[model samples]
Target: MPVGFWVFPWDIEDEGIDRFAARLDELGVTSASPSVLYHSGRALLPRAREHKVRLLGGPGANYPFESLETPLAGMESASAPGTGKRFWQGLAEARSDRGIRLNAWAMPMHGSELGRRLSVAVVRNCFGNPYSYALCPSHPQARRFAESLVGELARSRIFHAIQLESVGYLGYRHFHHHEAEYVGHGPLEELFLSLCFCDACMAGARREGISVVELRESISRDLERRWRDDVWSVGVEDVREALAANDDLQAFISYRQATVASLVSSLAELCHSESTELHCFSAIFPPTLEHSTWIEGTDFAAWSRVLDRLIVFGYTAGGPGAAKVDEGWTRSELEYAGRYFDPSRVNVVLNLAPQYLATLDDARRRFRTISEMGFNDLSITNYGMTSETRLDWVPELGRVLDAPASST
Candidate 1:
């Protein structure tokens, strides 16, 4: 299992590169995966290599759904064509470099009308619904756009693998649309709010005989009624005015997960043609959040056959229980994930911040346990997000990286 660190090169300058590379070398860390960015007509891969860190070329955190900004709408005419071109060139350079491996990390179905803010209203109006923030996997245009984008990226020849992310619906889409759907239902009832009710979404669902109008209307009415009843029972009868605001957060998780699976299947086909390896990283929450919806919707089975690797997000900072390193939890999660895809293809991202250097021991243990469970690769969260103190954690991380994977 090869281990690597993640960094943001968008802000990394030549001097900063020297410092970072020095740190990595001192810690005996070799390969590095930095965020993709083109600056001043040049990419950062060369500088990183000068520091002796292998660069993984990528758009960093570019989300496919939100890629369409009005100013940079559409794949062909997307923002800063030169940025991508420079990145491709960087990929070529990295390929020539001794240690780098360039991969396109794509956030597949991550929809956030909230993040788009001003533009979201336009998207909602155009799609004829405010709730349809995520691109409907059932939608042809979404698939076309995704395929075109991947094709264009693959043309660079610098990328050896394609990393898929989010690939699920918005984190809060279900919450925004269907809080009432589960009203009058069991408190613990499972909810996976399904989306894509726009013309495109509905039409796509029709192919499978799923009714868009009925589903939306049902949710709208159910939640509204439940809210009204709950208010009246509490003698807050005047609260009908706020009835429209009621929504279940869990529903968003459900919808997001389903969309992930659909989009992954579609994108996997596109990546395969280019002979590029496909990988996916979780977007919604850390594994401890118990996001089974994401796992099921973006079925690892679909990816295992087509993808070259699978990277699951095991964020610990806000993870349930003790954010502290719990090897038992890490082991269980890795073992569970190992059941889905080849252990070698699976990697766990350990988010480390320099500010959290005090937790280095815990974080290292988490990585060790995960790697021991058969995962070979480890992705450190972000270079930019790390603090000076967090930088202190690098040496300990190097030790964990060098430790042999558990034999069991």
Candidate 2:
């Protein structure tokens, strides 16, 4: 695997460009992706190039929930993506000279904390109201909004690929506390319920004569009456089977996948017209593991057939169980991911920050395992930590990423 770092650390803003380059050079890193701040600073572009590191497009640090597929000026309100066309143009030219590729990563799911703080809705939870800023695949407006955003980004010369991450709604159904009586009413009640009983949504369902309203009402009543009963204890098995048995729901998911595919495909066609590359980032939910029922509907495997590359964030494998039981947990996860997609077109993001950096020995083990996975490209969680802080292994982790994999 070509190991890489997600270099947008919160602390790097004040650190001078020279200091930053020296740090990467010391770590033996060949390339790094710029953060939103990096793009704004013209001085850092040449410095990164001089260091001979490939720089992917930085993520726009604006409202996370703003549909990248929408036409709202609100989506462009973020600083860099808002007025960074000139920055992108500069980046494109610089990358051409330096041989780096620019890829824009956008979060289409829940909006940023800023969006939540401002939204009137009270969809409260640990991760914020799931409704306020998430892009519900069931909504046409949400889909169109995403499509338009892609079109706008496609016009840029600097960004060659687009990384759509965390695009789907809340995962891990167990975490969805309000699913019982809430039905479609989440924190973003207006947006979430905006089209729940909408004419278009209802009409489409009516075409199948499925009566979505009746089904929803039925479930809502059941949930409300048994709200106190342990749905998990009572319904988990049935819910799982219900999710599996509904071929019709699965078909609906396929249709939604086709809708997303069409939007991305259209954007790709737009990019190809300009001779730019378009790609999508997705994750493979381990079959044995529990995932949100909605994920099966996202139909990403079908999506891979149409998009350029599928970047699987294989962090789940490096999770709690393996870490506690086996030192080689990360490697096993990467290998498992390889089974789903061709290695050449897949980019597995290695978790090298925060969670992985719990201890130096565990960190070293994670790195070694990732290296052996033979991934085409690699990325860390983020560049938020400093050498003095929680990251005692930054130098070692960086060295591991920069070094050639033993197998390679």
Candidate 3:
């Protein structure tokens, strides 16, 4: 079993790598995935040497590659640690001595600053309004940029694995800063609005013989009905079921998945050349969890063969009031994903947040359930974000998952 934590460079550098690795070693953590690149986010660190509770990462990879003439739109690599030692070098040091496997976490297209700065065609809604946070893979510039960055990371040969995240289409409702919405839509509405009809996506769909005009009209009508009537109109609760009633919708979705898969296939080929395992985050538009990656253009049928591992989210915690999550939710989601993905090539990410796994007992029970599911590869939600008390559950989690585990 491989047990690890998803952490940022600041997470390790905040307290210094030696101290951070010592903590992980004490908790029996086998792997540490430090973000080589990421999008924007605010984090709360429990063991910070400074600003224990402060703004965290943003878009860009700031280390010393000197690849670009000017820095990315944000603070040049997602709030890099302004410490004496560089994160990559310290990470290598920690890995060499602490036996911690370094997973290079990179967000390919999910960057608010970089996307806006580079003027890449991001995912646009049926109305043609850009989401700004996501770059469409169909765009040549976006594809080339992602390929160059990821290829560089793989060639570095410092990481045990290259964990690719947000390598596919992203959706609306990303919980942006002070984000607001009136629709309060469920799966269908969110899915329709999240569909990208940008020029790049449009041209690709047309080449695939998909009718963008008809699809747009279909989505418009559905949204109009949903907005005014407060119903899905088709009375279908599940996204798969709803999409089944429409051939164009299904075909467009398939095209999106194929585009994403093709990009990953290229990246995987590059990683293979460098002897680095390529793992992708099977995520996007949650409440759908494992089943919903399709909405964001990631599909096991398309990516499983090419990817070294597909990471799926199954949260038992952090759900809306008690009404959303139940005892069987995580198991059901994992079961659905297991039906499609090879267990040997899957890593299930569970929450370590206190709201979900409050105590050592909760961590123990969750670990046992996941272990029984035959998912030997597992990752906890994060390191810096979880509270001090909640992080104490790590030791118990390690005791339960001491065999093997990893994260990014």
Best by lDDT: 3
lDDT tens digits, residues 225-286, model 3?
77787665232356767688888888999999999989999999989999988998877434
Q: Go through the candidates in order and give the C-alpha RMSD of each one to the true structure.
A: 8.8, 8.3, 3.7
Candidate 2 lDDT over 76-188, as tens digits, reads 33333333344445445544554445566654433433224323321222223244443454455655545555555656545666666544433333122234544332221
Better of 2 and 3 by lDDT: 3
How well does each candidate superpose onto the true structure, as a TM-score? 0.68, 0.66, 0.90
**What TM-score does model 2 achieve against the real structure?**
0.66
When sorted by lDDT, best at the front, the candidate numbers are 3, 1, 2
lDDT of 1 by residue, 1-408 (tens): 455566544434433444545555564454565433211112223333253333322122331224444432432312222354554455346434545455655543433432242222211211245543344444455555456556655554556766655454433323332244434332111221233345554444455555445655665565456556863222223222232343322333244345556667666777777677667764444532343435235566555665677777655445444445445545666666777777777767766642332476666766666655657777666654455576567676666766765522
Residue 169 alpha-carbon offset, candidate 2, angstroms: 3.8
With candidate 2 superimposed using the best TM-score fit, by how many Å does residue 293's alpha carbon deviate from the native?
Answer: 8.2
lDDT values, one for every candidate: 0.49, 0.46, 0.75
Select the stronger candidate by lDDT from 1 and 2. 1
lDDT of 2 at 153: 60
For each predicted model, how many residue pairs clash, with residues at least 3 apart or on different chains? 11, 15, 9
**CA deviation > 4 Å runs, candidate 1:** 13-32, 36-84, 91-96, 111-133, 173-194, 229-262, 287-291, 316-321, 325-329, 354-358, 404-408
